[model samples]
Target chain A: GIQVEQSPPDLILQEGANSTLRCNFSDSVNNLQWFHQNPWGQLINLFYIPSGTKQNGRLSATTVATERYSLLYISSSQTTDSGVYFCAVASVYGGATNKLIFGTGTLLAVQP
Target chain B: EAGVTQFPSHSVIEKGQTVTLRCDPISGHDNLYWYRRVMGKEIKFLLHFVKESKQDESGMPNNRFLAERTGGTYSTLKVQPAELEDSGVYFCASSQDRVGYSYEQYFGPGTRLTVT
Candidate 1:
């Protein structure tokens, strides 16, 4: 099984600030995603970037498959962004079902 | 339209009791998966279903936990004689495709299970 590691175990940012989170995988993966666990405990899919780059609203993500790492950027952070950010990836060896392996996650706090 | 939907947003039961959780994937989505996150731990995969078949259940913890998908639409996870360790949040997700190249998984809000 491949291991996923997320950095900046904790973060505190002011509203309107920006932050970046990183995820490093032990091996190559077929699927990578970033999720925001909100105060209500809902896991909102932020990005599904196996490789290349993608953006939605003020959030962006880039996965460099060759480097076995992915980065998530949150710009103009909002108070609602306060919660845990998790990075999960599916090992290529896991077959086609796309079962995910999650990282420890980064807890983010956006202060008003 | 509808994303993955899970039943019983929260459940609390005594040890040795049985509980069943249900997940209904988006219409026409062929890939469905189950995952769990224990207290203070990262989410872990439980199993995966491709339509009506159990594609991969390698992540399942033990025989006490059973999952089934009938008619390739809705799925259920049954935990019998539940233990204290069974307390956690179970999440269900579904994707547009089973395999090939599409790998996005849309997750449900999750069902929080607490075995007392």
Candidate 2:
């Protein structure tokens, strides 16, 4: 099984600040996604980047598959962005179902 | 379009009792999965169902946890004689295609289970 690890276990920033979260996997993966678990316990899918880069709204993500790492960038962070950010990925050589392996989440707290 | 949905948003039960959690995937989705996050721990995979068959359940923790997907539609996870360590958030997710390339795996809010 592939191991996923997230860095900057905890983060705090002003509402307007920007931050980057990192995820490193033990092996090559075919699909990678970022999720924000709000205070209400909802897992909001942020981005799905197996490789390359993608952007949505004030958030962006980049995955270097060859290097076995991914990054999530949050710009103009809001207080509502306070939550746990998780990275999940499915290994390229996994079973037919491609079940995701989640990482130790990065807890982000944006203050006003 | 509706995303994955889970029932009984929260449940509290005695250690010796049994509780069942249910998940309904987005219509037409063939890949359903279950994952759990215990206190102070990373979320871990439990199992996956492709239609009515169990595609992969290698991540299931132990025999006390049983999961099923009937008619390849809604799925259920039952924990009998739950233990204190079983208390955590259980998440269910679904994707249209997992065996091929890659697609989004929409997740439900999750069910908070507390074993007293």
TM-score (chain B only), all candidates: 0.95, 0.95
Question: How do the residues A19-110 of candidate 1 rate in per-residue lDDT, one tens digit apiece?
Answer: 99999998889889999998777899999999999999999999999999999999999998899999999989877677889999999999
DockQ of candidate model 1 = 0.88
Docking class of 2: high
Query: Tens digit of lDDT per residue, candidate 1, span B3-41?
Result: 899999999999999999999999999889999998869
> Using TM-score as the measure, which candidate wins?
2
RMSD of 2: 1.3
The superposed Cα distance between candidate 1 and the true structure at residue A8, in angstroms, equals 1.0
Off by over 4 Å in 1: B98-101
Clashing pairs in 2: none
Our tally of clashes for model 2 stands at 0
Instruction: For candidate 2, write residues B1-116 as lDDT tens digits.
Output: 88899999999999989999999999989999999999869888899999989998998888999999989999999998799999999999998873554667889999999998
* DockQ of all candidate complexes: 0.88, 0.84
Model 1: which docking level applies? high
TM-scores of the models, in the given order?
0.96, 0.96
